[model samples]
Target: MRMLKRFFLIPIVVLVVSCGGPELPEEVALEYEALPKTLDFNQHVKPILSDKCYLCHGPDAGNIKGGLQLHSAEAAYSELSENPGNLAIVPGKLEKSEMFHRIITTDPNLIMPSPDSHLSLTNKEKAMLVKWIEDGAEYKDHWAFIKPEKHKVPKIKNEDLVANPIDNFVLAQLEPLDLKLSEKADKETLLRRASIDLTGLQPTLEQIEEFVNDESPNAFEKQVDRMLASEKYGEQRTLDWMDLARYADTHGYSVDRYRDTSPWRDWVIKSFNENMPYDQFIL
Candidate 1:
């Protein structure tokens, strides 16, 4: 009789929980499935928070709303003592979390970004936030502030084929998916690729013949060194920076007049050829 009674109660409990009650009850946990797994804090959740919440809740001390700060990992998890809510984030508990509640609530006064502030979260963003909260609300350092870490090269079966540590890492990723790197380009094709990349121009027929005929083991490296020595390489590299510096043949005005910016332009081209350190180049 007790066994039958417990069996009968399972459906009722599941029904109550599913219709927005509490966390999944352990009894029906196996049967009930969550929505598709999409709870990455960095990739999915961060962009939504940055766009919607950061303006009012972010690092700018002068404009923080409700004494909440969501910019840093520390602040997001902090308690909203001054505000009406208690905890801003109660990890692994979405229903009890105030941030999650404010976003999901239909009440105009309770919704986040506030209707008066003209900011709102889409259904998809709200779902992501819910899942993030349920997944322990893990936080990562802001991407700009994160320091780069050196990764150990992955060991792969085709050790002989690996050209460098970079190739080993790339091949390791591809190995799981049954893919491999394509074959090396022929000499003529390689020459053309290098020329265009370094000088912004295709290799001449004479240059192509010279590369194709070179039988030395260091032939490709020699060709690369030669291209780097060319004036065109410097000229091609500095085009973007020149544009950013607003270098032009003439002053950009209605009464346009020629400008003497050649000295600055020449300095850029010279800096590239000399392999100037980035800090010194900027200085």
Candidate 2:
């Protein structure tokens, strides 16, 4: 009856664990159904741990359960105190990794995010953890904590099409796919594009006719100037900064209520319309 009862336990936990959750094989023999891409510890694994496991096993010293802190590489990779010879994570060895077994186990008392903790790993998450540990369980510093650095602009073969620094990045992407910029847009199409880009409105019929009739080499430049001169330009441009500027017309937090913030909003639009110097606008 004991042997039959053991066989009825959750599908994966029984096979993953030992006779009484003590003995473990030395070989790295666990299999993954599929690993879609090369897993990165910081990007893929850290997010899962943060959302599900971190509540109990995270960096918070006061709430740490099981006396485990999995917020870093050094601690998780160390030997477990409770189980002298065992480790929570054994790089490239899932068979010997206790964390792997805890996450996979279905036993009410043994599984992590415990039965009453009301947290569980999805099948895909479980697989990702398995793949991560089997691949050596590498960890890295969170991206936010790292200092930022400027990268050299990537060069592309088609220098003729490159109009700005941004185009260099665009063409660099296209070069890999054996692609190039679409043929130069006709004057009418170009004017419409510039009108929409600068003022968020299509070129008026009068504007289209003016652009088509003017054969001057600087006709497109003049149209751009005209669009930038429009008040609509400020309205269109300020939209992108609305969220960045945190432009809300209310007292946010505990008690939300209407507030008169239109003056600042108008100032942003007015600055754009006045063609304020970049530094002055930022200041």
Candidate 3:
């Protein structure tokens, strides 16, 4: 598939705790073809922790299972009383890092995500954690919770080709790589792209004809407006929301019986078409 627009690099932030099956050996082999120069704490480590460790060791103070807390850097790295050593993680020294030792330990009793929890880590995840600690175990705020900031739009040589500040930002990245943006698609192509993206269907012949013949500079913008207001827009967005909600084919339990969720699904489509605010949509 051809990319319609150049995508600029954007830094993402997520708050997650590391959770994996077992500790890795002090001399663990890296799974990557090349080791990353820098490991992102929020991206690589947080999700693993969030999935496996957060229930017992996260922000909820009352539910903290062990005295150890891995959600925050201050807590995760602090010395724990149960372990022989004081520090849970010792930056830049994997062998001395107690957290690293526990996961890599072959002793069944000593492995984390304890056998009872039925959680396990892949070799790749273990390597990432190891690399992260070796890189100094830095922690930062989760990306989502951070306040949104306006970034300075980058300057690019292809100023005439850019449609917006976003395009300028994308072009700036491409300039350094010695790459250039593809030519804009014709009006008929644009119509089809917009239709499929927003409504999951192609533009009709008449719609294509009208768009191609229109000479107005804002013709494409009008088409975008049309798709956003279309009934199919609601349907398309509802399908995306379904994944986020973890909608499944059957009841996710022992019985695994089929169930009806059409009403709930329909409500989602209705809310989307109504253009509900993000906070209200979650509520």
Top candidate by lDDT = 2
Q: How much lDDT does candidate 3 score?
A: 0.72
User: Model 1 clash pairs?
Assistant: none
Deviation in Å, model 2, residue 92 alpha carbon: 1.0
Which 10-residue span in candidate 3 carries the lowest summed lDDT? 3-12
Whole-model alpha-carbon lDDT for candidate 2: 0.75
Off by over 4 Å in 3: 1-69, 89-145, 244-259
Candidate 3 structure quality by residue, lDDT tens digits, 55-131: 76788988775467888889888765343345767787765566676565555555566677888767677777778
How close is every model to the real structure, measured as TM-score? Answer: 0.56, 0.50, 0.61
Which tens-of-lDDT digit does each residue in 1-283 have in candidate 2?
Answer: 3422332232453564565333332222222444445887777889999999889788897887655678998878876554455567889876677677777666766677686879887777887888888788988886755576786899788888977788898898788779888888998888878888889899899999999999997887898888888999998898778878767766745477778888888899999999887658877
The candidate, 1 or 2, that scores higher on lDDT is 2
**Location of the lowest summed lDDT over 10 successive residues in candidate 2:** 22-31
Model 2 regions more than 4 Å off = 1-13, 16-31, 81-84, 144-250, 255-283
Look at candidate 3 and tell me the lDDT of residue 182: 92
The C-alpha lDDT values of all candidates are 0.74, 0.75, 0.72
- Which portions of model 1 miss their true places by more than 4 Å? 1-150, 242-271, 279-283
